[model samples]
Target: MELTLTDDQQELRRGARRFLAAESSPDKVDAAMKTERGYDPATWQRICEELGWPALTIPEAYEGIGLGPRELYPLMEEMGRHVACAPFFSTVCLGVNALLCAGTEAQKQAHLPAIAAGERTATVAYTEPSGRWDASAIKATATRHGDGYVLRGHKRYVLDGHSADLLVVAARAPGSTGENGVSLFVVPATTAGVTRTWLPTMDQTRKQADVVLDGVRVPADAVMGEPGAGWAPLARTLALAVTALAAEQVGGAEACLELAVEYAKVRKQFGRPIGSFQAIKHKCADMLLLVESARSAALYASLLAAEAVEALGAGGPSAGASAAFAEAASSAKAYCSEAYFHCAGESIQIHGGIGFTWEHPAHLYFKRARSSQTLLGSPAYHRERVASLMDL
Candidate 1:
């Protein structure tokens, strides 16, 4: 049950597939992930400057294409298909959404142009060592200082944190907890008392880092939106991020299915193609169902996300609409996370010994599936969120 793509969307998908296929082949993906930085600078530069992807979601006023999630989701799918090693997920999905959802006009003007131009990179700092993705998980503190605020906390699992030029950090007011006192601040990566150490995560196709801000100071103007009221925007950003990531999972699952099908047709067993066997046929059929279902889930989530983002600019959605959107986002995340993981595992099983080898791309997909399943929130966690949102 795939969502029908318009002509322009189809064309964009084709172009992205061609570009990633040429620049981010399996060998390239392997080489890039082995790098300390997790991606090649030259390739990323072309992805930005030539494809104008960082500019895809930024508003036209900010020197961007002014497109939204609908357009960007397909591109994300292509990235996943190629296991492309880039910070497009961190910069475009989280950074651009953070600024758009929470930043003041002045703040947006000051930061977004560089991102749209692909001259700077940024990522959000929210999750801590606890590895929780909820607002209740935020334990960082920000205290009023001399004409600025002092932030203190440790952020872990920050996407592309080690090399990003800026960090949009979330910390609450001193002595406050939970959603009420939470605030978002934009701090330069080079700021005093800030440290970002590479994490060497399992999914090296995308890098992560440990960010420690001990007395990191930022001007009051660094706050994105009102200090105590940032949760709404942050929640919006997460929903969009989940939707975007689900699309990527769909792409990966699809690729795994394709790889399995291709291998099944070629590899011989019992003097005939393995695809001729009922077991292989069953595996391929199951994979096809999972891939298609995941694609549908991601597409549905993307549409809801587009509505939510547009609603943000139009004074936000009604409480009911917001709940519905959150429910859909969590539902998609949960289903796609498990579906992708299961599909990857099945693909590996279909390939047998070759799939288990580190040299094969099947294991890479399996690794990505497992890592991504737990990144934002595990399938169980998202299911709980969906239940809560639905008042069940």
Candidate 2:
């Protein structure tokens, strides 16, 4: 199949690039990162209203724009370029994916519409203090009551947890262990026993929180899908998240490459501009190559996700499609994480003293790159997954 963006996709990318460049200038980005919410709620609402970003990937039946993964990739890339601070990535990509994959009809009707309409923010609470991403590693317990469930657990590093209106929590059933007992619940953040504390980190633009569910009670209908069938959906959601994140990393890396190139051309060296030197030229070239390669991988994975959705509708259990998507997602995540990290570090090195100072934007991108590498899984973790998939 030919790998090219359609006219509509190109338009979406152009629009996103224009909007981010205008709205998230370096000074605005700095101000937003230091805010109490780590972002400007008013600005975020304006973006959602103007761009329809939160609903880009949702189905039309749910009041969304009804675009697919292919359309979303470039939009996400542009957002990453500016290091735009918003809950769109966590709420729309991760939270919506989990609900779409595993939610009951009632649950979907209740939550998806609000999310698609940009009226509510949501997140997936899976990672705990243990810091494991696998479903089998969850230790939070959910106990069955007369007509509801009681949740008692602590989830750390929850993206947008403090501001989210809804949470999709992963927990083990009282008697079950490992993947077999894990289940997903849709808990309102305003529930009686829910508490949230923001966590400080290197990346100031992206917010994370520690969420404590102290005997949080929810109706039985809150459970997503069958009691024991949560793992498959969780894994699928994670694969999609990996693809989206890889696209973001590629965007960030591309930005770093451009910044370095522009600085090199203007900054004078011993006798001439540093960009005229062979060493700086080669570094810029390598950064370009890495960004281009990672872009291809991200797009490939996104296309696979779209194809898998289609194939499942046609023949059911498209193992080949699923495997292809999963492998590609892992490959993209691993390669893009390392590539962005390298680009960030090299961009700083090229700027020398200024890059190390707080006044420069290079350090912001560097911190984002480092933090994003550990978001879903580290480069090393994804490499191991890739190896396992290849049976090497």
Best candidate (score: TM-score): 1
- 1-392 in candidate 1: lDDT tens per residue? 24767789889999999999989888988998888788899988998889899999998999999998889888989988888889899999999899999999998898899998889999999999999988889999989998989999999999999999989999998777678999999888999999999997778888899999999989999999897888888998888899999999999999999999999999998899999999899989988988888888889888878888788778889998888888888999999999999999999999999999988998789888999999789999999999898778
Model 2 Cα lDDT, one tens digit per residue, 1-392: 64668898999899889988988877888998897577888888887687678888777878888777898898889988989888988898889988878888788889888888789999999999988776656888889898989999999999989989999999888778677888899998999999999998779889899999999999988899997678778888888888999889988999999999999989998989999999999999999999999889888988987876556446544776677788999999999999999999999999989999989999889999999999998988888888887889
Indicate the worst ten consecutive residues by lDDT in candidate 2.
308-317
Measure candidate 1: CA RMSD: 1.2
Q: Mind sharing the TM-score for model 2?
A: 0.97
Instruction: Candidate 2: give the clashing pairs.
Output: none
Off by over 4 Å in 1: none
Instruction: Estimate the TM-score of every prediction.
Output: 0.98, 0.97
**Candidate 2 lDDT:** 0.87
Cα lDDT, model 2, residue 96: 90
Count clashes in each candidate, considering only residues at least 3 apart in sequence or on different chains: 0, 0
lDDT of each: 0.90, 0.87
